[model samples]
Target: MRRRISMLAGVAALGLTLAACGGGGETPAEDSNAQDASGNVGVFTWWADGSEKAGLDALVKVFGTDYPDVTFDNLAVAGGAGSQAKSVLAAQLKAGNPPDSFQAHAGAELQDYIDADQLEDLSSFYTDNDLTAQFPADLVDRLTVDGKIYSVPSNIHRANVVWANVEVLKKAGIDPEKPAEDLEGWFADMDKIKATGTIPLAVAGSWTQVQLFENILLASLGAEGYNGLWDGSTDWKGAEVTDAIKAYEKALSYTNTDRDSLSDWAPATQLVQDGAAAYNVMGDWAEAKFAQDGDKPGVDYVYFPTPGTEGVFDFLADSFTLPKGAPNPAGAKAWLTTIGSAEGQAAFNKVKGSIPANTTAKTDDFSEYQKSAIADFGQDTIVSSLAHGAAVPVAWLNDLSTAVSKFGGDKDIDTLQSSLGDIGEKFAK
Candidate 1:
């Protein structure tokens, strides 16, 4: 489970062997060489550490077995949630020096790449690989643009989970088994935890703040209202939105005061694992981290959908796309094939704390939390996750993140609401 994938690029000498075996020794066109097909496939992602990196390593293993000739050049840039990698990737794509394939969110966030003509049409890749019938139809639809699929989703993650340390909750005289039924109930429990001198909630800076705000929005506005936020229907200044903002403000009060100093979501989750905090609202990936640290799911830590979000799935997918003009087009396609395959997905999600996007993947090896996630994904009302870059364009998400960061410092609800209104108007147009 803690295996590290070797990121070494196979020696360039192997490309010569491949070329020599193909026919008479007439050198092939640079773009038509086998190296371009199955040589070093530059696999790009932000999975620089933790279970996320382990999962990528797992997938890389699968790719190596499937195509022994191809070398995996792991181009991972370390930053929480692709914050640093995305900027690097954008520059690469803009300069036409694209990686063979790169990780991306599977919804509207991909529209920018599609708009910029940086991605290859992957519709035929789906059909050729028989993936059209293997992946969820709705997921396929979300990944499609202009009647063509562009990315292959590796796994699905739920964004509305709250991870709590059972011991911390018990110390606070709160029942760990019975999580709050609503936002008000959550506040009441937070009060009790506060009295016990534990950090009532643990939150990290930047994107994690947006993740919390979005879940709070889901809890306050319900699934329908939450969906309306991405579309043109939800009024950002409405009373429901106001209520959500108020709830977010109150919830912020219970968070660790040192939250601003925490750079990543894992540290916030660590607070819960170390029993310094009662709750950490985050994606299910935290479960994988806990498991890696030898914590049992129900005993050491427990999870529930963030309060008031019981029947909803704030969902996002980690996907990979074939960038146009890739150096190793063949290797890229092979990598995508493995990503969309049942065996590959099963291997990846088992370590990554997500459910396979491929429905045929067996869940027998998944953890208890992952099993519950599979069930929830099957029945819950699905909505795009704003924090994970599924619900809006990249620019809009950046703007929203900036607004949330400012709100964190200023606590100005009116200004925050106005900014959201402007973002909505700009994106809607």
Candidate 2:
């Protein structure tokens, strides 16, 4: 996904003044005429290229059918982890001139906007549109705060996938169609891949890499130890978490790749695409990269959950949120509605490599990997990805990332566990 969301104001003081005044007020206000008024939807996002962009573009295109006059102004900001875009968005909202719509995660992450009263009460709109009928209860529950719907999800994404280069696996004397079921088997396969002169694992220190680390942690520790770290119900200093940390350190030893020097998600993905690396830990959306490279899933590449992890499902969802005070309230709402509509969700996820948030949407557009993802959703053991920064509180997530990175960089398991214990205490407070 491209990081293309940025602030659209302040290029010129006079220009901003005129734009605000043009709204027929001294300061910009919501388009009350929306629904009853012609509303423009100003969307802020980070999807600047590739299949991710295609998904959002499809949503915008369909939105035009129902709202022609509602001009869709997209502010594309480019920054990994959306850090730069988020900083700009914070400034705009703080200055009382937020975008009509912006993207937000479908978990506790939205609490920041809700705390600032910078989000609208979407309860009525959700009811009016009957969105509950299509969205899963868990998804709707995640986006709801108190009693109001603060956002509308476009799709669900699964973290914790092991993407392999089928050709590379064959060269390594491993079956591309069948993956190892446990950590020992996984390591053995990696050794075979390494013996073949291919990078056994394509990894980096980037946020996405950290996400992959967390997925592995969950697989190594199981859901009990995994959820305990963030839910305030389990101890991070336990044998399970320690074992997970040790496994991560051992895995990092195998990350000897040209990608070790880079910090982007695409390089690791490209390694798999180019068949330079035997495996990569990424989300199912990686299927898009494989498809883009003309590689066929199950033939050129295959997906499996991190080896040996039970309850082998990780859940996360993405959505667009309308800022509380928007210049294009109507357009934003229309876009949100379009996002939830079965057609829009299907169209977006088909290209983006994610499952539609609307459960009613067809999965035909998804590739073989995504088909398995949808099947996984049916299992009762699915859990959220704390490493991808979902489900857990932001503070705990950052802390966990720091601790995990240290562990990956050769920190002792004992020290890593101690750090986790300290972070867990802070989260509890």
Candidate 3:
């Protein structure tokens, strides 16, 4: 039987309080000396492959230039979208062995760490560095909890994007420039590609399915309804959600049959890159992967927001936080400062296939796709990404992911709807 939503809330609150209180371990002293001490700094993340790793290496290169005395420890664990890293992080935090700093999604996702008091309040760091002026106001708001900032954002990624192979589209006799306007239209294009002996869509297992589902929900419900999913203004059990699920089911039907065997997003992206598949719905980071493989944007592939989400930026950010018990608090602060710096973010995002979170960062080095994302991020209705831990708590997202995985095998809309409604009631509050 499923746990009651209220029960989960109580447990979460207790966990947060215990986590915040140091969990019976020696936490770093809150003094200028501790904040300035330099030694080895361990930075944890799940950026162990492809363009993501390249991005991390670029940032590390910049850090090495600035802090030559400090040894940079790359504690990257292999996982798609930090799935494996998160589990390790949770265990470490519980054992009172937090890294010097670690990557996290901005927004409600960081709330857990904030609640646990496992994170140092970076409010002073932001004020000292003038980050309040550098980053966008909306993005800063997302990174804040109860008026206290916890993390410094490195880059912004758009989740609702469909990357297509231009050559594959040409082979299927479909116009690459004119993408479909809705689900039905997208299905028509997929049918044409399928007829040409090419896989119409490519998707990886589990987490990517959640990524695709969130975009489908955005396309089906539009910005207002999608925002309501997090804020309690929308009905999860309503007909609109059901319609979104139906659309997701149809979309999944067009995906690669061996999707379960594809362990990470990079392989599925490679399917589109190699032209075994025509399209892949993934975050803009896939752009970085293609670029790393020596593929040019317009000539090799094209990207657009998923159907019906053209004007909205489905947003998430890669951010780093200073853990409470970090062995090198000063070094962690220095690392985070570098992450928020203009030069550092530019170097990182240029390789990572994302836009710098700092609005003041120069974009001349950014690709056409990244430039467009930056412009849209500034002008569009911004919404948090569910799959990437921006819109919900870790536990809530885990529950949702479990339901999605079960639904993939069961194909039971009724069960999916029930599980979704229960999650909404529990987490959306």
Candidate 4:
């Protein structure tokens, strides 16, 4: 992959420092040495339901314990992958009605906000709290652009995991533990699954499809080529992309017809866990869903890299940022300080089924899947996720998602590939 945002090497050096699951801590609002705060602090996020909501609640508990005086306003608009929340935030920011703090993925996704002066630099915030040393060095670098940091990351999520229902796979004559070597091999297994009258792949919404599309690109193009899609080294209209989407289209054939009814990704994940679906290709956040559904790993469920994506980590981080004209900057800082704290990360990421961004957080209570994810993240070849805003700005991703969504409806590969090419060209210019 390109060296521009090479983060795994740095993350690996510090990644294992993160520790166990969420155990509520503090005096009702204290995340270990968080400066006291008061008044209402509106923190915007997409984690309004399911295990994702649980993660936010865990963090909020820590915040409440540390800053008892502050009333935390949960300004969450439920949506898969912030599909709805981002647009709301954009509108609010433009109208000069910004939340005190908001969640954003920590890469090119922040570009538009920074360019438009919609965000406040958190560089001094980092220095004051000693957060620079707490997070992986390369991760810190990824957060910085023009020598300023605009957000404090909570956790790292891997986008290319395939969660499987062991029983469902077993019924389909598929080995839950042994992942297929590539897309073709995976599709062969999916065919068997389809014959079993099970959803071979449970996908929901455009975001999920875009996520699957990127994983297909990774499997087809490798890390360097996938990275090139974002960095402009690879042509989106090239033969490589055409061949890749063929696999993507093939993968889609095994999905459930009721995908449109499944608005959030959790229900789709639930299908796999409930044995109604054989597989669900989702980010590690699905781990939280598995746990939430009381599915045990290796027994009730299993996971691997999306076919052909083994040894590659499709990465995205969830971070909180201070808006330029936040209503309560001090309260927002308190929220951020708590978010960056080891205890807060421990609590939040534990329920979130993601590894903490803070390297120094405790790790003794993590689930088996989480432990495996931390290990994988430490050693895997990390690449930015196009669906989750690590690789492309939100606008560009929306363009890609629109094209992918349309493809899902129309099944027109030529139009899909051509539209994507135009999007790439437009973004590149």
Better of 3 and 4 by lDDT: 3
- Backbone clashes under 3 angstroms, per model: 0, 11, 3, 12
Which candidate wins on lDDT? Answer: 3
Top candidate on TM-score is 3
Each model's C-alpha lDDT?
Answer: 0.80, 0.68, 0.81, 0.80
lDDT of 2 by residue, 1-429 (tens): 111111111010000211231121223323333354254556777665665666678778887776776667766565434534655566677777876667755665566667778777777777877898887776666566677777787777877778888889998889987788888789889988888788888886656657766776777867766666566677778777777777777777677545446655667877877888888888766777677668777777887778876445776666777666676565666777788889888777887788886878977757776776777766736666664445655556667777776666566888888987898888753
lDDT string for model 4 (343-410, tens) is: 99999999999999898999789998788888887788888888878887768888888889989888
lDDT of 3 by residue, 249-308 (tens): 999899999998887899999999999999999998899999999998888899988988
The residue-by-residue lDDT of candidate 1 on 1-429, one tens digit each, is 121111010000000001111111222222333333555777777788987898889999988887788778877777677876676677767776776677877667777777787777877778778898997776766666668877888888889999999998998888899999999999999999999899999999998999999999999999889878877788997888988998999999999999989989999999999999999999988878998899987789999999999988888878887777776677777788889899999999999999998999998978988998988888888888888888877888899999999999999999999899899888864
TM-score computed on alpha carbons, candidate 1: 0.92
Q: Give the lDDT of residue 348 in candidate 3.
A: 95
Give the poorly placed runs of model 3, Cα more than 4 Å off.
1-29, 33-37
Q: Worst 10-residue stretch by lDDT in candidate 1?
A: 7-16
Q: Is candidate 2 or 3 superior in TM-score?
A: 3
Please identify model 4 stretches exceeding 4 Å from their true place: 1-36
